[model samples]
Target: MKDTDTAEETSPEPKGVNLFGVDPLIIQDHYEIDYRHSYAQDSPFFVGLSKGDLLGSRCTGCQYMYATPRSHCMECGATTTWEKLPLIGRVHTFTVCYYGGESFLKETPFILVLVEFQNVNTLFLSRLKSIAPEEVHIGLPIRPRFTKAPTFRVTDVWFEPMGST
Candidate 1:
C-alpha cells in the first residue's frame, strides 16, 4: 500500500448557500449547519449552560470524563455518567479570532482555547475572555464564567483568564 503521509488530499472550497433552495452554492455549509444544530440543541452542553454549571460525562466503568458530553466512552464504549466539572484548567492551546460570522459576536476579537483538566485527563475547547492577545499563552490558567440570559433562558458559556476576578 502507498503511504498516505506522503500524499496530500485536495478539494475545492465550498461556496456559500445559493439563493434558491434547489440550487446549492455550497453543499458543505448546509451539512455543517445541520450538523451543528443536530448536536448543539437540547444536548447536555445546552443543559449545562442553562444551569450555570459545566457538565461532562464520564465512563462509569472507566472513570474518564468527557468534556464535550459524549454518550459513551471513547476508550471502552461504556455508557457514561453525567457530572459537573470544576471550571478550571490550563490552556494547552489557543488562537485569537478577529471575526465571528454570527451577529452576536461579530467583530469581537476573542480567544479560542483548548484547556486541559489535569485531574480528569481531558481537554475542553471554549472561548476565553478578559485577556489581551499578548497575555495568552500555553499553560495559562483559566476559569469558567457562568452567564444568564433574559427570561431565564441560558445562552452563553464563557471563560476568563485565571486571577482576573
Candidate 2:
C-alpha cells in the first residue's frame, strides 16, 4: 500500500553484516570455494614431490638450469628437460614473514628461503622449518623433507636443518 511497505516486500534478505568505522567500512561474511586446477605441463614437478624427489628444468640448448619447473628455457627459448634436483642445498637468502595470503595466514611468522644447490644456476624458493627466524642465516645447510601423505602440492615438500631429525 505505502512506499516503505512496497520497498520491504521487494528487498532481498541480508546475508552479511556491515561494520562502519574510522577510515573505511568493513563487511563481514563467510565465503568458501571449491577450486579445481590442473598442473598440465607441470605435472611432473608435483609428482616428484610425492616421490620425495625434487624436479627442475634444464635448458637443452644453453645447459642453463632452473630450480623450478619450466617447459621452455628463459635464456635460449629452447625446450627444457626434467632434471632431478639435489635434496640438499644451502640457504642462499631468507626472510621472516609476519603476514601471508589466506592459505598461509595460519602459518604466519614462518621463514622463506632461497635455496642454492650445487651446479644449479638458479635458486629455489621454499619454506624453511624447524628453525627460528633469528636462527636462519646465509649459507645454512638444509635438506628437503616430503610429506608421507602427499597432496601433489608444492607444500608437500619443505626444507629443514640438515641435522634435524
Candidate 3:
C-alpha cells in the first residue's frame, strides 16, 4: 500500500477532555424563535385596544356581561357577543407584585388591579400605572390607557388613576 494511504488508516482519532468531570455542568446560551398564532374568536378584543377601545363580551341568552372577552357564557353556557366596555372603572381589588414573568421582571414591584365597571358582571384584570401601590384602594377610580402603536397584546392596555395624564 502507498505510504500516505497507510498513514491515514493508522492515525488515531481526536479526543476531547471531560472538563465537567462528575459534577453537573452549566452552559449559558441565548435562544429565540418566531412564533405565529391566531386569536381566533378573541381577535376583536385585541383589535379594539388598537383603536383606543375596550371590548367585552355579553351572554346572548342570560345577558350576563364580562369585562373581559369570552367566546361562551360562563353563566348559562350560551354564546357571547362583543360589547363596548366603559373607559372608566373602579378598582375592585389590587395587589403589589414583587415578582413577575420574564417580560415584567425588570419592572418588578408593579401593581395589578381587578377593575370593576358599572353594570358589568365581571372584573377586568390589568396593570395599574402612575400611582404607588399603597395609594390603591378597593374603590379607587381608574381608567384604561391604550398604546398608540399596539402589538395586539394584553399589554397594549393598562389602567391609571382617573384624571392622571
lDDT of each: 0.74, 0.92, 0.92
Q: Model 3: per-residue lDDT, tens digit, 122-141? A: 99999999998778899999
In candidate 2, what are the lDDT values of residues 1-165, reduced to their tens digit?
675587667665444533242344569999989999999999999999999999999999999999999999999999999999988999999999999989899999999999999989999999999998988899999999999999998899999999899
Better of 1 and 2 by lDDT: 2
**Sorted on lDDT, highest at the top, how do the candidates line up?**
3, 2, 1
Instruction: Give TM per candidate.
Output: 0.68, 0.82, 0.84
Candidate 2: deviation at residue 52, Å? 0.4
lDDT of 2: 0.92
Q: How does residue 92 of candidate 2 score in lDDT? A: 98
Error of 2 at 51 (Å): 0.7
TM-score preference between candidates 1 and 2, better one: 2
Task: Report the poorest 10 consecutive residues by lDDT, candidate 2.
Answer: 15-24
State the lDDT of candidate 1 residue by residue for 84-112, as single tens digits. Answer: 88777888999898887574376478788
